[model samples]
Target: INRLSSALIRTSTKCINALDALRSLKDGLDQHPSITKEEKERLLNFISVARQEYDEIAKKEIQKAFVYSYEESAKVLFDNYLDNIEAYCNSTKLKDPITDEEVSPDEKLMRSIEEQIGVSENAKKSFREEILLRLSSYARKGRKFDYTSHERLREAVEKKLFADLKDVVKITTSTKTPDAEQLKRINGVSAKLISEYDYCPVCANELLKYVGSLLNR
Candidate 1:
């Protein structure tokens, strides 16, 4: 529907609900006198099928859970990990951002991120060193190193972030009636999708359920 709306009908698709667009198209077809009855009927039939498909999928997906895209949250975690990873590889301590205490680099955390892109335990040192070296180079060049600095690292970071959030996303999305905290979080996430991620409320909620179902499976 979204693709048809944008590419075929030239409707604004992003943040504009697909169903709404289909309905609007149906209305236009109904009113436009120049379009032949046969063509109108054929298009209307297509819209009906599309609407049914959308409805059936939405009914199934409404209960599933999802998180924001990689740019929204994953890189933030990746950068923080980068800040402490070198020390972790060096067998030293790093500061905990939340607790303001010296803590060891979490081997599990580092490996969890690296494992997503097929980094092996034996090669972990070289990966970390390469990342850190790039970080230094970026700093010297008056720039910032990020997931975009390394392709595999970006994939790893995104995959790790999605994996790490799976359980929480499942809980949040699958709940029919959330508690106060959950409701707040849901509203905040939805709002962020609308404001920052260019999703309309309809698509945003639909996306949450879609990802939620994927995680459950």
Candidate 2:
């Protein structure tokens, strides 16, 4: 059961990671001005399809893990039952029946044990089926992506503008040192670009300094 649980966790992580990668790719497309609007739309649609497919795959993996765990649990229970029955029979030295046609004590005990095991297995199977039905229903519900989507969009915009503004630095450097207003414009553009991406102030400052150095060179 522990091993099966771990497998399920690993499977879920893999699915999440794959979805994250697709999301990152979509964000990159959104930020790239070189990519046409139509192409971006097509790529976004592809990502959507990939997400749907991954969701289905994750559902199936969860179901498979549950089924395997339950089956293993049943087998362990059955084995423990057999071990307990054997111990009981060994501890109690019961003889065979006096009459040749009569059933022996050991035979009777084996029959009872088998009947009990059958009952337990049936109960487990019914319970497993019920849980699976509930899981299927739960999986059909929609999930929220607002927070993640917003973050990805912000990051994409930041990356796109940063690349675009690199050219501005080069152009300014080709001429003499930029005046106060020119520097202000450059700082404004950098600030606006990083703000959209939600970069921390320290990181944004460092990025601006790097760009300033490039312009000075």
Candidate whose TM-score is highest = 1
Q: Please, what is the TM-score per model? A: 0.54, 0.27
Candidate 2, clashing residue pairs? none
Q: Quantify all predictions' global Cα lDDT against the true fold.
A: 0.71, 0.44
Model 1, span 88-201: residue lDDT tens: 767789888799999888888888888988999999989999888888899999997777688788768766775666677678776888899777767777777778667678
Best by lDDT: 1
lDDT of 2: 0.44
- Candidate 1, residue 111: Cα displacement in angstroms equals 1.1
Q: In model 2, which regions exceed 4 Å deviation?
A: 1-16, 72-217
Model 1: colliding residue pairs: 64-212, 65-212
